[model samples]
Every structure is written in structure tokens, then in C-alpha cells.
Target: MFYTLVKIIHLLCACVVIGYLIYDVFIFSHFKKNRSEVEFIKLKRELLKPSALILGLAFLLLLCSGAYLASFYLGGELGWLESSFQQILVLKISVVGLLFVFTPISFFYILVLKKSDPMRKFYHHLALLICLIALIFAKLMFLF
Candidate 1:
């Protein structure tokens, strides 16, 4: 029961982050770039702050649940480190860690750097790629 609950929570959190990343990467960021001053200001006032807060919370939940899930298989007979799945899992975690780091940096850039800055796109696309990779790793983990 506890494992199932945690797995569900973990999957939900991953879904939240992945959905938001895809939207931000392919849609929101581009829309933000092209929006007029009034539209951009409206976005900053209404959406940006709330989205950041949600993303931060989602990332936290994902991190904690993911860590808990990983802990179950890391030692004893499961020995995740010895399995073929270990490398991809580790890579996914590392990418998630990078996402965690980049989240704040992207926010800081949004706050400080001009909207015209292309760097945020770089970060967004990188995050999108990692999210896709993590999803694939997740599937492989279930199968193998």
C-alpha cells in the first residue's frame, strides 16, 4: 500500500513537471518572447510568479518521492547499482538535479535578464530533452 501510494505520487509529480516543461519549452517561452509590453506585464503579474511557485513545489515533491523510491532498490538484493537499469536511473536523477539547479537560474534570468535573452530557451530545451530522456528511462526501468 505504502509503495503503491509513493509510486503514484512520484508519477504524478513527474507528470506535472514534464507537462509544464513541454508547455514552457514549445509554447509559453515563445509566446512570452513575442508578446507585447502590456501582455508581458500582464503575464509577469498574473502567471509567472504563480507558475514558479508551483514548479518549485512540484520539483520538491518529485525529488523527495524519487529519492525514496530509489532508496528501496539501492541496496540489499535489489542492488540497483549493479543492474543495467542503474546507469539510466542515475543519469535521469542527475538530469533532474540539473533541472533543479536550472529552475532557479531560469527564474533569476526571467526576473533580471531581459525577456529577449535567448539563454532561457537554451535552458528550456535542455530541460525538455532531459525530461524526455527521463521518461524513457522510467519506461525501461519498469520493463527491465
Candidate 2:
């Protein structure tokens, strides 16, 4: 029952996070470059906080539940690690680990760096790319 609940939450959060990540990468970033100031501010005001919160919760739930599921169901199985499924799972986990590292640095950069800093945009785009890749790899893990 506990596992089932965690799995549900994990899946739900993953959906929300992945959807937001796709929008961030393909929609929001493009708007950042091309949209008018008033339009961009409106979009940013409407989405920035909600997206961040959802993505943050998704990451948290994904990490906790995924680790629990792995440790609970596959802890003693060496062959699982040797399987193609496990190889994809390992890659997914690696992407998530990279996200864990990149997220904090991105947050710090946002908090500390001036908006005028040229690297801010680069960092923001890179972080979004990481999140997108992580989401894609995570889905791939379930297929194999």
C-alpha cells in the first residue's frame, strides 16, 4: 500500500514536472528571446513561481519514491542491474543526479547574479535542457 501510494505520487509529479520542463525549454525560453516586454512579463508572472514549485515537488517525489522503489524491490538483485531495463534506469538516475547538482547552482545563480549578467541566460537554458533530458531519460527507463 505504501509503495503504491508513493508510486502514484511519483508518477503524478513526474507528469507535471515533465510537462513544465517541455514548456520551459520549447515555449518559455523562446518567448524570452522573441516576445514583447509586456507579454513576457505577463507570462513570466503567471508561470514562473507555479512552474518552479511544481518542478521542485516533482524532483523531490521522484527522488524519494524512486530510491525507495529501487531499494525495496531490487536491492538484492544483482541481475537486475545487468539487465537493459536497469541500464536505462541507471542512465535515468544519472540524469536526475545531474539535475540535483544543476538545480542548486542555477538557483544560486538566480539569487546572486544580476539579471544583466550575460551568463544568466546561458545557465538558465542549460538547466532547462538538463531537466528536459532527465525527463526523457526517466521515461525511457520505463520502456526498457
Candidate 3:
């Protein structure tokens, strides 16, 4: 019962994170046409009243719940260097780490790139791509 509850919370948190990511990528992708960076940012703020706090909270939820789930495989996780499943999990965790690094740079970039700037778009696309890969790896974990 506890595992089931944790698993459900983990899945729900994942959905929140992924849904917000998809929406941000889709909506802002179009701002490149006529919007200045300031205008784009203003529009984004106006549209999404909720601060990034909610996203961060959801991420925290995922982390805590995921950690709880992983604890069930304490031995395997300890020998992650040897087990195939652990190896994959380690990679997923690494990618998620990178996602954290990319997020701050993307959102609060020093230069604040224009919408047309490929690097800005690159960051968003890369994050989603990595998230998708991690999701697949997580599903594969159940097989192992």
C-alpha cells in the first residue's frame, strides 16, 4: 500500500513537470516571430500567473518519491556500478541533473536571448528530449 501510494505520487509529479515543460515549449516557440524578448517575457508572466515555485515543488515531489522508490533496491543501488538497471538509473539521474543546470540558465540567462535565438530554443528542446529519454528509462526499470 505504501509503495503504491508513493508510485502514484511519483507519476503525478512527473505529469506536472512534463505537462508544464510541453506547454512552455509549445507556447513560447511561436514568440520568435514578432515579439521582443521583453515583450515575450511579459506575455509569459501575464499568462502564467503561477511562479516557477509550483514547478520546483513538483520537482521536489518527484525527487522525494523517486528516492523512496529507489530505496526499495538499496543493494542494487549501492552496487550501481555493476547492475545494468542501476547503470541506466544512474544515467537518468545524471540527465536530470543536467536538466537542473539547464533550467536556471534558460530561465534566468544573463544575456536573455531573443526568442529566435537558437540557443534558447535549444535549451528547451534539449530539456524535453532528456525528460522523454528519462521517462523511457524509468519504464524500462520496471522490466528489470
Better of 1 and 2 by lDDT: 1
Tens-digit lDDT track of model 1 for 30-88: 76789997896687567557778878798788889999988876767877578777766
- Per-model TM-score versus the true fold: 0.74, 0.65, 0.74
User: After superposition on all CA atoms, what RMSD does each candidate show versus the true structure?
Assistant: 4.0, 3.9, 4.3
Off by over 4 Å in 1: 100-118
Segments in model 2 whose C-alpha atoms lie over 4 Å from true places: 33-42, 77-80, 103-119, 122-144
Clashes of 3: 0
Clashing pairs in 2: none
lDDT of 3 by residue, 57-81 (tens): 9889999998898777645547655
What TM-score quantifies how close candidate 2 is to the native fold? 0.65
Q: After superposition, how far is residue 43 of candidate 2 from its true place, in Å?
A: 3.9
For candidate 3, the per-residue lDDT at 104 reads 62
Candidate 3 displacement at residue 134 in angstroms: 0.5
Number of the candidate with higher lDDT, 1 or 3: 3
Report, for every candidate in turn, its global Cα lDDT versus the true structure: 0.77, 0.70, 0.78
